[model samples]
Target: MALPNRLRRLLLGSDPRLARMLGYWAATCLLYFIGAALLILQVRAGAADHDSAVLLIGIGATGVAVFAVLVRASIVMGIAPSTLAAWQALFAIACNIGAYVVTGPLRGVYLIFLLVVLVFCTFSLRPRHTMLLCAYTLGILGATMVWLVATYPATYPAYVEGVHFASAACALISVTLLTGEMSKLRLRLKQQKEDLLAAMATIRKLATVDELTSLANRRHMNEVLVAQERRIDPAGQPTCLALIDLDFFKSVNDRYGHAAGDAVLRAFSAAARSELRAQDVLARWGGEEFLLLLPATTMTQAILVVERMAERVAAAPVAEISGGMRITFSAGLAQRHDREPFADTINRADKALYNAKSTGRNRISLG
Candidate 1:
């Protein structure tokens, strides 16, 4: 039968592991139902005992109903997936024990079901919990064998029961060791996948971000410029590019050492970032030179933005540059020409910046 929508969603939520567990349980239950029906047909034909066939069918139906209730309760109560899996394992063990009691320990094939349950638990349960379940299963099987021998001594002799017990114990131990190894391998692979993702993130950051100033690096800036160029249109608002150069930056480094120069660069980058709009792209073009891309802006607005940035940098002296040494920058603004190549646009800005430096420092010039 199909599950209700709400219950189906609860069992098959965002976690794939939970969905797989529920799917496996449903399939196993269906198989058990089919097996019990076959047993009933055999009983009708006098190939199997009628009482055992009836008992098996009853147990299978009850087990299915109980499992459905447990699944619903776990989802409704927001039980942890691992905890739910543990509960399911315990229920499976109980069902196996019940089946063994009905069919007699020596004749029952329920130990095969127990092995399958153990294998399923290995996927969701921890190694210790799986091991504990294995121990519990072995204990239950051993106790069932002793009880059968004590009650039906003629049918289950001590020597015969001992051989069966030894064989079952060996099989359980082998499966436990195998599943434990498989679990360890799965965990290791999961860890490796996580590590690989972390490394990829680090590499991407290093490729696009400047180490010294934490601004977008030149390569990334060029890519951004190209993307903006493709988006430009004569009918839309104009795009502007600004080339900024730190005035007398070499002197700062030569006078105060490279460390102080680095401090100044970082301070300037931070100040410019704080003053600019979120849409503006600020990148370190090279030593002491930064590029700013302002989309949907005119040349006049770009100039005003650069002038404000210059004021901010001059007002806030770099702390590391002893004696509160002040810093200034010269910028050149250029409006992107209709369908013009991005490189040509950048060249125009660069020329204007040179003009600003040659004419005077700490001012904005239009290209």
Candidate 2:
């Protein structure tokens, strides 16, 4: 048999963290590949010593692969996702700066390549972590500048100064591009999440709440009542039920209109909801009728609650109608004192409600 949508989502589509982890790992691997390839090409092109070129490429590739593995492992162990990404970016920045320190930033376009990798790392990581990594990177660059000025002033002569300036420009440009892309992606993802939550809320309301009265609907009520029955003590404490019916509800519709009737219903619902205890479950059983289930309440207590609610409804003014139509409700209370079936309890409540209606128009009765 085919799985239901909810089951499918829970089983196959709900693991967001896995996607994030895998995506990050894949991007890291891709960056490593690009950086390694560039390093190999750069070394070969600028090889005053051919043997050094092969050795440099092999060593750089192995070190980067090891770093990638360590970063991924650390993330899998116990690190927070954002923190892991930040550490990964920091490691990348450290690698780049370490290369610059060893191989002279004046090496034709090598600093530019390192700058690109640094930008990639910054953009790929979380914002606060990225900032910290950038600060560390800038510190490395500053230290490198100071070292060059102090020790190798002649090495980066007037000709090499232009190369260094161009390298800085490359770094700035790369950072700007990647930062812009990352920001846009973040905004899109956030909006998508908000939209998804709103849709879920709407779906939940449709499933569990009455559209007009905004009370728990029949389905939700059934779920709650069944769950309550499982935990209810038959011989221990009483379970009370209140069946409420709006008096002259059909006349309200006939006198004013359906819209005015809706207004009256909403007003009564609001009042009844406010009067209910936090533990009481209120449900719209059907049109013009509502049910309140109160566990661990005696028949007397339930009748008192019903009387108070009836008075409250009688006092609360209905919303504007064509005529000044007053609104009132009749309530019936029933409590299970001994072992009794759920249906019998509800039937007793209905009988009490009928008695309330028969005795007077607006009053409470108990059975």
Candidate 3:
């Protein structure tokens, strides 16, 4: 058998934004570590000339690794505060600028780190924090470019001016594309949340409804009765309870089978439902049994209503079942009185129904 849906979601799935952020950060850190190690190795090959620089680069690489580990751990443990995430972003940008200064120029490869870091920040951080971090990153990148132009004029020689200009253009384009992608992700997440809520509401409604009869089931009737009781104005209105039991229902099921019995039940419910007024509530209480709650109705008024319902059920013929047999119901009606408990009223109605069933099966009895 397949795994349950919730288990699958828990074990094999992740939030899209978080997954993207994790991948971007993991790849970026790995690349930076590898690049830094290569640079240190090259300097070590010429250690006689660049001993101090080689040692410094190795230290910076180790620092980056350590910071990455700390941030990853905090996020995994759900302990990374928003303020700490902002500080981490600022620190990473500062370290990037420091690396460029140590190397005497800003290489295009540094842009890769900046772009990856920006994507990761957008995914991991909130909108306000991510934008603030983005601003800081742009500022640091600008400063690094200015430093390169001032300290290493030949690095951006005027003879190849277009190359330097084109790199800047590319950086702008990358930032634009990444921002649009983030916006799309946000929209998608919002839509997913709405869809989930709608599905849950539909499921809840279906739980309280009978599939075949389209009537309120037992559980739903109980809930509605309690809610109505709480809303009852003790001085202004009265609520009546009625128990309706279908007569000779088992005979129909025994003769025509369950499918035919279902059809007859549905037909009876539809006919009975048509006889009810807007202020009344009806539910399928159990097999061959139904309950009705009539608000602002007295015993006489409730009897008339129950009699009409009984007449409707008795008159309605269920075709394609039991030689098109006619169905009949017996109902017992009781009205709420001052100082009477709700449960007691229901018991009185039930007793009235028992009396009605004993006297004859196709009429309404009042208590």
Candidate 4:
């Protein structure tokens, strides 16, 4: 395990994808060794000449070294691994076919290894490409069989080559079809996994976001406040909370339609978002009421932010179809005391908000 890990680091650098593809490349190189061994075995059986087997072994060894270098270079250059793997597949098929043509009486051994080529391709190539390689293998081997029967009828009888070709074709085509089905299954499973992840993300967004205003909903805001309460720092800048209520919002719905009332709320939320600082949070606290959280803000700064938000709302027509009526919200601000419970600070702000509503509709009051 340690040696393979070190080899992967040295050869493939740090990319796990590259390392996996290199493993496939190594298997094809191993097939080259197996082919050479088969040929050497045939030489000992007197089915192929010693000189021919030795020469082919040397060529196979050199081909492995060359492709290893090419694979290493492709990894370093960030080239697509499949592209080089395609080239290696072609090289392997050609070498396997050459070995089959030379191995006299024991050439059928190389036909079995041709199926190994298709298996390699099932992992490395697209299904269609693998099937295409299968067809190429059939065509080339058919041609070789015809040539062998004509040139060396004593060694490769016509009926013998025919049976060999038929058997090899059956095995190759069967594996190709199986690999095609497997590839589709793998693709379908991957797409379903992606869809599941996306649906989970949508569920999370609906949990946090208000349906109408797209602001944080009440439950999510409470979670934020609870988190904020846990991390209060006395020496750090103060945090402020403001409870805001839309003035006469029920009357607006009574005068105009609910659609116009909804439009006003949406437009007001948009404006509030634009006016608030990035660190601030505003939540829709159910039906024309909202809570604003201003981190690192004093009461004075919170009041200024609330006042600016009020002026911005008055400057724009929140509901153009409702005679372009301006909207106003009364707010009450409270600077959070160190170690004070968040609920108590909110209660003080809510109480002060009632005072602002009782005195005048558009003004802010500090708690």
lDDT to native, each model: 0.81, 0.70, 0.70, 0.85
Model 1 lDDT per residue over 112-180, tens place: 777788888777777777888889888988898899789988877888778877877788788888998
Better of 2 and 4 by TM-score: 4
RMSD in angstroms, all models? 3.8, 9.7, 14.8, 3.8
Best model number under lDDT: 4
lDDT per residue (tens digit) for residues 1-367 in model 4: 9999898689787867766776877887777877887888788888887887787778778888887787767756776766776777777777878888778777888888888777777665778888888899899989988998899898889999999999999999998899878876777887999999999998998999999999999999999999998884777889999999988889888888799789889988988888999999999998999999999998888888998999887776764446656788999889888878889999999989999999986889889
Answer with 1 or 4, whichever has the higher lDDT. 4
Quantify how close model 2 is to the true structure by its C-alpha RMSD in Å: 9.7
**Clash pairs (backbone) in predicted model 3:** none
lDDT for position 5 in model 4? 86
Q: Which of the predicted structures, 1 or 2, would earn the higher TM-score when compared with the native?
A: 1
Q: What is the C-alpha lDDT profile of model 3 across 1-367, one tens digit per residue?
A: 3568667444334565344444555665676676566455545564222554566566666766665565445546675545444555665566555554444233444555665555655545665555666666766666666666677677655434346445644774567467657856886898999999999988887889977789998889888877876775856777899998988889878888888889888988899899999988888888988889898888788888888887787778777564546788888889887747768888898999999999977878887
TM-score of each: 0.85, 0.61, 0.54, 0.82
User: On a 0 to 100 scale, what is the lDDT of residue 275 in model 1?
Assistant: 84
lDDT of 2 by residue, 283-328 (tens): 9999999989988887787777777776676667765664555678
Residue 362, model 3, lDDT? 82
- Model 1 ranges off by over 4 Å: 1-11, 14-18, 30-78, 104-107, 154-160, 232-235
Best-matching candidate per TM-score: 1
Candidate 4 ranges with C-alpha deviation above 4 Å: 1-16, 36-85, 123-126, 232-235
